[model samples]
Target: MTALPDLVLFAKYPVPGYAKTRLVPALGAAGAADLHRRLAERTVGILLQAGAPVEVRFAGAEEAAFRQWLGDGVRLIAQVEGGLTERLIDAARDHPHIFFGADTPDLDVGVVASARAELQNHDIVIGPAEDGGYYLIGMRQARPELLTDMPWSTDAVLRETLRRCDALGLGVALLPTLADCDRPEDLARWPQLEAPGRCA
Candidate 1:
């Protein structure tokens, strides 16, 4: 039997003062959190269109809270305590799975399809974010070293990850560059959140 494709979504629980903190200076506390929740919802809705099983591994909230937010029907998994890399490692069990965070509001099914298709030939696939980070990562198997300690939230993230992939001899495929909502300037990427001073 063919193995099913898994899509792991790493998301924050949208708690005020915890989620989308960088945007809080502009969107305020509750607004930023609310916006994150909406963005995550949009991402989940889009992923569901791919007709593949999506496991939502979340941080900053409990299972019941996630169910209440994303719905009881969604497959919700709590993220293990640690930094981003460790949490990512925890969710790397599903073979040929593509994992992404909830910050990219415009994520669509085509990118997902491309990632899955690219994984057929490449050992890993990564979608670069315009901000120098990555929007998604697709892997054929768990490769913890590929996700080890490194500079995160910087333009060097994508570059350093590629370097590590080379060091590990993992063939990687690159996807189209996308944007994620993490700061006030990044809000411009999404139309609804682009109005000046709206969040301030």
Candidate 2:
């Protein structure tokens, strides 16, 4: 007699010099910003095709710009405040959601399908990225402790999150490893050819 929860996709406004900081040296701020826009659009495109009731959670100062960029079919919510942990905790409190960065172009439909399937049984689901962080994370239930006091934007993030899951006795499912377009070197690892592969 309980209604199933909704899925929310978290992202940020693609502001130049602010988004994708690691790739800026190789891509320049403008180029990196352009890439961010493309990445977000592609992610939303795929999620839209998945045919689920979904909303986009934009985290940053420019909520208006993000809303304009994302446009239609997405209900926009400003992250308001929180580090990654706080924002995610807030999101999970409202929905059984999955959050993914805009950087992973290779997150195919099958992988997303697998995540939704796994969510049926698991408390949390993680899609590990080739870099130290994860591309996607989903939770059927909110466990704020799993996200607190952990390093963000490091290779240790996924490992530490898993550790917290263990500490909290939460069941987690793993999705296939995908490449996150963080550093300049990650461009080669991307499966699609939407643009020229820029390297270090």
- Superposed on all Cα atoms, the candidates' RMSDs to the truth, in angstroms, are 3.0, 3.3
Point out where model 1 deviates above 4 Å. Answer: 194-200
Residue 25 lDDT in candidate 2 = 84
lDDT of 1 by residue, 30-149 (tens): 888888888888788778878778889988877888888888546888889888888888888757888888887667889888887888889999999988889999888898887888
Alpha carbon lDDT at 21, candidate 2:
75
Model 1 scores a TM of: 0.91
| Clash counts for the predictions, in order | 1, 1
Give the poorly placed runs of model 2, Cα more than 4 Å off.
Answer: 1-5, 60-63, 191-200
**Model-by-model lDDT, in order?**
0.83, 0.75
Clashes of 2: 1
Worst 10 residues of 1 by lDDT: 191-200
Q: What lDDT tens digits, residue by residue, belong to model 2 across residues 1-200?
A: 33343557777677789877777887788777777777878788788776666678786656677667777777788775857777877777644777766778887678877888887788899999877679888887677776788888778999998988898888999988988787788755653432534311
